[model samples]
Target chain A: MSTLQGAGVHGAASWRITRILSLRWIVWGAAAIFFLNLLGVIAVVIANSFATHWFGSWLPAGWTLKYYAQSWQNYQLSGILVVTLQVAFAAVIVSLLIGTPAAYALARRNFPGKRLMMLAFLLPIMVPPITYGIPLATLLYKLHLGGTLTGVVIANLVPPVPFVILVMTPFIEQIDPRIEAAARMCGAKTWQVFLRVLAPLLVPGLLAAALLVLIQTVALFELTFLVSGPGSQTLVVALYYAVFASGIRPAQAISAMAVIYMLTTLVVLVVTLRYVRPTQMVGTVR
Target chain B: MTLSETPVASEAIAGPERRSLRHRLADRGVDRLLLLSLPASLFVLVFFIYPSIYGVVLSFRPLKPVGAFGNYTHFFGDPFLRGSIVNTFRIALPAAIFNVLAAIPLAVVMRGAVKGQRIINTILVIPISLGTVLVADGLLNYLGPNGWFNRVLMAAGLIGHPLQLLHNQWGVMLSLVITGFPFAFLLTLSYISGIDPKMESAAATLGAGPWRQFWHVTLPLLVPGLAITFCLSFVLAFSVFPSATMLGNPNGDSHVLAVAAANTAFQQYDFPMASTISVIAAAIELLVIGAVLGLRSRFYAGTTTGKG
Candidate 1:
């Protein structure tokens, strides 16, 4: 029944073939459950966030927007949102100011220690940020920048500048350099050549790098949580404090905050995924 | 005639000037452009590198000189503290292994044209963006006693009693899988797509069965990619903190090293002990990384070229 010569797939009607097809279905079935679980959990969170009373029933007893309003006033999210924007914007702006030109150099030139330099930049993104957050927070405190918005911004910069560099270097490498050369031949200075010749071509790339950094800064909890003080907590840090800081709170109130955080992150994420794949953020897995 | 003739003659005279100017600018431009790397490098070295080094150095500071190392002694002295190290491994090991292995079958099954491949991939990636804190929040309601999960099971009469799933080891691992699976699946899918599809088809034509084809041909080529995915997943799981708190017994069975480290630094103000724990965590991570990389070299020795 089982011989080496006909063992190959051309045999066509073995019990193994039927088993394999069924196994395929099994894998898909499991995968379907996986997606369902993901969506279903989020659905629960969303439904409960607005539910007036979710007692011992399959669905909530009733739904209302009271929790959303209560969370806004109870948690004071507007100020937190402002702080979140400030930190995310600062990180993006400073990183682009510094990382883009650095990326150009790294992309166009061959220098000693370049590989090591690239590795140093890669270290932050590759390793867990929590590993470095402790010391960075301590250092910021020592410098009197700790516990302030400035401190959070500085701590947040560690991961994404390197990320922006990694994102932007490839973009710079793809541009034709002869354009810069031609601009220089017409008497353009270094700054002028970069601005007038290269900058226009790189606008989309810079926007991408900025948006990626922006989302990362908003989503970044470990570093921001480590360094933030009472007055300067970002939305994520504030969300943590809101959930854990008190007693006798309604689940719906916390869920409302979660929903707000989720929506903000998803909006930015949708824009980002439109521009880049997850693989492109790291490297091609292939 | 004056304008045209004068411009042409001036261009001929200024030719050397133009060439000389270009050369001078080009010579000076490189060093200036290279200077661009300095600010960012300085930021990383000062903020990222220097502090990490300081943390390690601070950890090595004497902790009363009573034991092999003071900071580590104090850290390991308390059973609660030492248990964190063990607990971290407990949560990380199974989570990493299961997430990576589960991804392989799902990846292969999803490889061919599925009805909603794009939507599935999108949903898979959503958890990655969810972050641990939000995920843990969702886990609380879903896995808690009165949550819809238990409600559904009760309605179906599948079990008699409610399962105390949350605030335990199972919850932490499940959260890790929820986060880690998408990443591992993404990487594996990309890797599988890289292999020549024709190879598997050829094996099929040779009369090798599906099982044999996958075992003999596909599995061998996937080893290196699997190694990478495994290591990355390990790194992710090893750093579990937020979920461990939200979903597990904070100071009891599910106490992880990260919480302990944070406690020492922030709550206890025991900077030395905190640094010691940080260093150990980093050291353990590096060791695991090295082992996986070593295995990668062996697996890919003849399988890859151009990388070395």
Candidate 2:
């Protein structure tokens, strides 16, 4: 026997079907609005950088590259860029040196206290940095490590090392153990197997981790702001200082600098997405 | 040396054969793992653990070498400073919940094969890299009185006056959502996609509707992921300093925990008091995290299978 079409036969109950349909549309419409505003905020900033006067209008009053020039001149983009690069590169190298092996160990060998080890690795990245940053900065200050580039690098390492380990552990686990046995059968030692058999396979993962650490170090503001000295400011910290800096500068000029920051991060992000899924950056935390 | 026998079942047979010549070398590497992991342990120990402990201990030290609660009492006992604790949770709890909720439907939509998926994803993830400070600046211009949002509302005659959106807790909340949403969305989308789509399809074949399939089959598996994201987003919001100062009413109740900790430690040069606030902030954060995780496990009931 065929089932009756209750929704079509019952005229009084027709609103149930319609209600479901309309509710679907309402949900989608809400999602669309959220997506637009998310992108809209970023667009507004990029547009405002070029705007001469942007009040009371959907678009800017006038547009020019003059703010870019002003931002470059006043912000010392050249110097800040150099420091940002140095700090990011140094942090990545240190994190990789320490993180990759730890990842390999965690991946290859199951041992006692493994869960505790993983939890320990997770805590630095999991807890808000500001909670520990206050004390970390104080310690650095006491040891005269604060406000130096070295101090900034040390502080930045607290999170990204865990990140590298988190990202790399999965990659290491994905490699077939049989391949390592083959390399061993050919008379390669553990270090040799890792360097030769594993290094080539791990390059892609290491690159992803490095890029993530790079962007993280670049974008990291709180720890850097706490510990960095006048000479050690990264692009983000400099931008924070510039936001509240004395004197009236054009919004376009500040937005110009923000645009520069956005471009640098975006370029690296595009490169990162090529190597790793966005899911890998986030969902792998567990 | 090679294996003595090529067994039909690999791992099952290999489980008892750890004494092979090649196994020794692999074991050596495994042993070296402890050595290899040393630098990270030292790094975290020196920079992270020691300082955190010092900060906690220092918070308990009294300014006058009096009672153990002197430092905490000096701040928490005072009415003006104590309000910051309430203010911090007020901003954090709702903002965290909002970000996680916003991420869920967006993740659902993104999971579908939408047009311009890559471009859309790139745009969505951009805010993750924008950091809180940049978003605050953007809002100060975009959501500010003269910025695009207000201008649009005014041009359309939707309101007679400019809405008070900036320089308040609301502005700070806006920045947190902007930064927090993308992060929570990315994680949620990953977790949802990780769920076996066949499970939902099976429910559909069993005469379940879309909403019913989602509520019954998918929602149970999503609890753990959502819990972790909520905790993370909440932590991100709780440690509000720059955004609170830049976009919030500094003189108002929104002067949150981290900002207060920073002011006590740095501006006031009261290291003990600052440490005390940091400890309190951390305790509150851990408490919230514990409650969320406990609820999450109860809801999830060990059904999660996405762990790598």
Candidate 3:
């Protein structure tokens, strides 16, 4: 009878523990609800883009693919797509060119005013684009570079270079310095030490940083929007115009444009995740 | 004998001196690598730094032909322009607080060897990739007057009419949360993951319950990081431009600081006023960040990670 009473007490304690732990369940449930809502948001766009008629109903009345064609022709999406690709690629290549070597120096060297230099680099990333973009855009227009692809590319480059430095600094720091020492000790020149020993190890980091920057540039709207002209508008900017333009076109066409933009970013994002964790991009706060 | 002795001393000193100079240069690898930082530095100096300084200078020259500080006086004098700052804070603060608060629990759970952590992270980051434009577009349709959200509510007999979810403050707030939450979650995860789990384990060994362990041990360690996450989130939300214009009624309730700046520059052709507004927005953003960081130092100011 005493042992049976002990078992009952143990059951009561276990039940209390579970009740306390149900807090975790609440957290997960909230997250799940949020995730479902996001999916629904995206789903509605996709469905409406293809729908023949999507009034207040559980589903669209019918489905079609002609909206994509209408959007492409109406918006001159082909030219915009080309410009988007060119700007994204150009920005990525230039940023990596300037950023990688700086990241290497930052990781390896202990120079005077290094902390100040770092803060300088961090400033551009911390300050929002719209904050500085206005003056920059004004200056670009004054210099005759605004309303051109070059202006957009230059404006977009401001953030990504610093971003590459921040992301790659830690990656370069993770590398053992002794490899460079060993290479030098083997009678390798400084350039040789960098090229033969460091470059191979740095490739993965370079790839990851490049891809992340690429994804950012593709999605980057403010800088591009501020400087881009009618002829030079990127996909996102063009989509914005289409959505807000006089209501001659159907909603389906605008949704179609949004879907295309989504696909472009999603493709790059999927590729980027393979190279780097999403947290590492923004979490290089320190 | 004196001349020979002087020559011998000179040779001895010159040989080692030249060799050591080269040795020092080589040892530091200062030949060309550090100079590589110059190009990137110059690029930022010319593009980022110069433009900001130019903006500040330009703000002194208003188009309305007044004093150097005329734009500032005008901005403060006008209720509509000044109220944009208040409107921005209204949207940014709550969204940022909610993001950080919600992210902490999720980060704590994910810090462990949790299942589907990667999947959850990927799903959360989708809004970031979608960018503000698409997110605004999606939210408009999904939460519109006849959207599925209201449909479900009506089907359940919860409300008689579709709730006004768009063209107001709520629309912008929702968009900011959706886009900004991933950033908060990711930053918090990195920070919480950085904290040494050994501290929590030790607390548990000493008979501390999970809640007690979190409050006493983990919470103190996370204070600095959470502060940073909140600041970053606030900055992003405070600079709301496209979403504020697209989702919210930009002409009235959602007339954020960015909209004011954009209109001053593009619409009114008042470049100086636009620059002035942007500078003000940036200053406000910095003030909030400074305040939070000041608060953070009082909470916990030490090594926040195992790596440290």
Candidate 4:
């Protein structure tokens, strides 16, 4: 009887554990399916890039880097890389110069129209990019700015500036204005107080903003496609051409190039997560 | 940078005079800030605001040298253009509904205390950064004839011939879902995570089952997030371009508003009609976004008891 009771107890506990385990398994199974769908495309792309010849099989018949090697030679993916980096870097610098001060003013001052100014900056984030891109392109054409690198950069600023301001506002709010007041009372000029005292406190926020802007600039396609002509093609535009203008083989090369692009993005994301704590920034605003 | 021992004529300067000078300096500072804002404002005005106005104006004018309302009339008269409006809604609405529905369960799973949550989250987000062109290319490779899916099906004795997954409406929808699901999932996850876990536990303690607890305690709290995610995903899927052009039959069957606008302006060089379509698309987007924001404010007020 004692042995039977012990077995019964073990069975009861096992039953309870299995019940919970079943729930977990069901949830996780569904999640796995969804995630597989999400990631399957990228897996396929990578697989194709390496496949020597795989058509009627679950797995490739043979694997080789031949396709990737061929793609690199034919597409000049490195040149596109240079073009992407240059445009992204230039856009980030421009956004920083314009956005930093505006963010400071918005965060520090309780002036009239402050709410209105905040709304203006936030509007771009809410609106669709195509809504603005079409009109902006038309205007660029009128102003003789279309088909130029500068035009693409300028069009890009609409979104990046607002993004920077939104991200930086909270960071700027955390800084005690009393530091600037003290410096000013100590006979420092306004510019000197801002340069020496305020800017240093904002370094982390500035870096985060710059990094975000850079990533956005690189990922941007709609505005760049509208404004950029043949000469000013970015990697994304080139990728589009490769897929549609060229054929599948060249497109695979572009996809390889995109994988490289994503790697760069991974690096940026890692750096941002390491250095910039978004929660801390949001906490300061509250 | 030493302070001079000289009195610096402080006694000579009267209180009123010093006050006026300080006021003048403050005024000058304000003026300087405003002056600095001018270049940016002008850039916005000339480039952004002006083009918006020009777009509206172009929509009313004819394509000929002499201006007329002929283009707007022409667009309205064309049944093909009218059909695109229906086509856009048909594609966008179903995709939005499917995406939002799927996202809720996925978000629930993601929010749960699960192993490898971060890894899963990262994988889920990978497609979002890939953009339309790359994703379409991947789809072509996988879903095209002699793709992996067909090979597997044939091997399993499911079918003898390869499936026609591409060059159809289903193809476009599939691509949209693949590209758009991550956005909805992430937004929903963030919103759902913000809910207090205590509420669900409380419901459980009150003799509620898991499903009951979710229905009673979780779903209501998720409405605000659900609405926002729905609107955002709808707008995104509605403005489909590269995927439709690449994977679907874009002649007229899959021509969305964005594509239609491009066809008119770029392909046909009918700038006036293109501008009209763009204006219409923008207006509709603005209205929908406004309605969503309004709903958000109402929900916040009701749920928070006027505290916010």
lDDT (0 to 1) per candidate: 0.83, 0.83, 0.89, 0.72
| Clash-forming residue pairs, model 1 | A8-B207, A8-B208, A9-B207, A9-B208
Better of 1 and 3 by DockQ: 3
**lDDT pick, better of 2 and 4:** 2
Candidate 2 chain A lDDT trough over 10 residues, lowest sum: A1-10
> Which candidate has the top score in lDDT?
3
Residue-level lDDT tens digits of model 1 in A1-286: 3453375655546656667778988988888787777777788889999999987677899989999999988888888888988998999999998888789889988776788999988888888877777877878888999899899999989988888889889899999988889999999998898788888999999988887787778888999988999889988887777666635578899899999999988988888888766644334322
On TM-score, the candidate that comes out on top is 3
Worst 10 residues of 3 chain B by lDDT: B299-308
Structural similarity to truth (TM-score) of each candidate: 0.89, 0.89, 0.93, 0.83
| Candidate 2: regions farther than 4 A off | A1-21, A54-58, B1-30, B302-308
Interface RMSD of each: 2.4, 2.2, 1.6, 4.0
The superposed Cα distance between candidate 4 and the true structure at residue A266, in angstroms, equals: 4.0
The stretch of ten residues in a row with the least summed lDDT in candidate 4 chain A is A277-286
Instruction: Write the candidate numbers in order of decreasing lDDT.
Output: 3, 2, 1, 4
Q: How well is each residue in A153-221 modelled by candidate 4, as lDDT tens digits?
A: 788888777677787877889888788889999999978987888878888889888876775677677
lDDT of 4 by residue, B241-271 (tens): 7888888878767878887887786788777
- Pairs that collide in candidate 3 are none
Which residues of candidate 3, in runs, are more than 4 Å off? A1-12, B1-31, B301-308
For model 4, fnat equals: 0.29
List candidate 4 stretches off by more than 4 Å: A1-24, A59-70, A186-188, A248-261, A267-286, B1-46, B65-69, B112-114, B152-161, B201-209, B291-308
